[model samples]
Target: MASGNDMKMAEETYSGFIGLVKWGTILTAVVAVIVVLLIA
Candidate 1:
């Protein structure tokens, strides 16, 4: 079993990872749109 501190740390890491992924996806989409506009 994990300790309370370990669990808290894991949660914070997961949250940060999720936030990074979310922004990454949004950035990718925005860049894709910009590229398409430039091409068209």
Candidate 2:
């Protein structure tokens, strides 16, 4: 069984990973928009 501290650490890690992915997707979208504007 997982300890309480271990569960907390895992949750933090998962949340951090999600945040990184979310920001990465946002950045990719912004870049795409900029490129489209430049092309247009």
Candidate 3:
């Protein structure tokens, strides 16, 4: 049984991780497009 505080902390960590991953994916795609354009 997890305590309320522990659950809240876990949720916050998960949200932050998700946000990081979302931004990372967007950055990767943008960089890829730029690279392709430079090559072409």
Candidate 4:
């Protein structure tokens, strides 16, 4: 059904968004650690 397909698409989009946020946070944390080490 079209409605079922639409729901699947929405779920995929939501998953991708969460993945992006998680990766962004991890990257930021890594960068922060590197900067701190460099400055020290």
Q: Estimate each model's TM-score.
A: 0.94, 0.83, 0.94, 0.79
Summarize candidate 4's per-residue lDDT along 1-40 as a digit string, tens digits: 5598899999999999999999999999999999999999
**Tens digits of lDDT, candidate 1, 1-40:** 9999999999999999999999999999999999999999
Give the runs in model 4 whose Cα sits over 4 Å from its true position: none
Model 3: CA > 4 A from native: none
The Cα local distance difference test for each model comes to: 1.00, 1.00, 1.00, 0.97
Off by over 4 Å in 1: none
- How big is the positional error of residue 22 in model 3, measured in Å on the Cα after superposition? 0.4
- Candidate 1, 12: how far from true, in Å? 0.2
Those runs of model 2 whose alpha carbons end farther than 4 Å from true positions after fitting are none
Better of 1 and 2 by TM-score: 1
Query: Which pairs clash in model 2?
Result: none
lDDT of 3 by residue, 1-40 (tens): 9999999999999999999999999999999999999999
Each model's number of backbone clashes? 0, 0, 0, 0
Instruction: Identify the superior model by TM-score, candidate 2 or candidate 3.
Output: 3
Q: What is the lDDT of residue 32 in candidate 2?
A: 100
